[model samples]
Target: MFDNVGYRPGRKPQNATQEAIFAFHVALRTGMRSGEVLQLGARTLDVGRRVAVVEHKTQRYTGKPRRVPLLSPAVRLLKPFAVQERIFTIDDADRDALFRKVRDRLMLKHLDFHDSRATALTHMSRKVPVQVLSRISGHKDIRILVNRYYRESAEDIAKRFA
Candidate 1:
């Protein structure tokens, strides 16, 4: 679990870790899957247009391209780390290792790599409609977004009813 696994605490990441953190933050803020974020290339980001084209891992449903509007936070985090060829590139094993390291460092429990996408979707859904959120997240089916990504709490329900 994340809270129990203490790899590093209150310490900044070194060279590679910093880049990994930047990539993770971009995925977190932009509602992008880890694979999508990792697949990003320099040509994928159009800063003048403020849009990023992400190629989904599973192209069976959503096709090849999904445009994501870059938030200022995501842009700022990624700008310095961007490379000429790829924004972020790590093999599946390395990606998982990096996520584990980040989870341990942050003292987060039960957080998996895919959880970042869910977290981003949940956060975005609070401010946007399910349809809009689905579009932004490149989910063709709203059911996937609602059933899997959005986590509603008892406190929220009670507040709504109150």
Candidate 2:
């Protein structure tokens, strides 16, 4: 979908300004929500262990913390952007502004930052099961996830029946 916007799969972003871009790619690759990505702090990531501690948004079913394994690409992108105490900080408004700029720069129309979360879920569904995906996504219910986040293609269904 973003091929026209110069989104090359497995391509690393070039600069600090593109850190968010790199982060976005990592989020999608790891099936993380945008809020989870935004809330990441220095203590959240353990580069040596290649793990990330994620605080799930207080939802009914999932009120505790969960851990996500970091991929090599995500680790590489995050190391340079990591600060002493804070990993990444941006206010809500600033986040929105940044999203707008990134969307425009990428020539994406009507795409919001939160959409990245959806994209991540959609893409990762093929590789992982709903149960594992729910853990990473912090979704309270698997049914909600199946209904909302997981994107199924008609071809996928046809192939299943065939």
**Which pairs of residues clash in candidate 2, taking residues 3 or more apart in a chain or in different chains?**
none
Candidate 2 whole-model C-alpha lDDT, 0 to 1? 0.65
lDDT of each: 0.69, 0.65
lDDT, candidate 1, at 159:
75
- Across 1-162, the per-residue lDDT of candidate 2 in tens digits comes to 334334454444334334455456657666676666766667787877877787766734566567877767667766654544654455445556666777787677788666667787776676778897787676768998888777778898587679
In terms of lDDT, the poorest run of 10 residues in model 1 is: 1-10
Report the number of the highest-lDDT candidate: 1
The candidate scoring highest on TM-score is 1
Candidate 1: tens digits of C-alpha lDDT, residues 29-55: 788877778776677877666678877
- Stretches of candidate 2 off by over 4 Å are 1-20, 59-63, 80-84, 157-162
- Rate residue 33 of model 1 by lDDT: 79
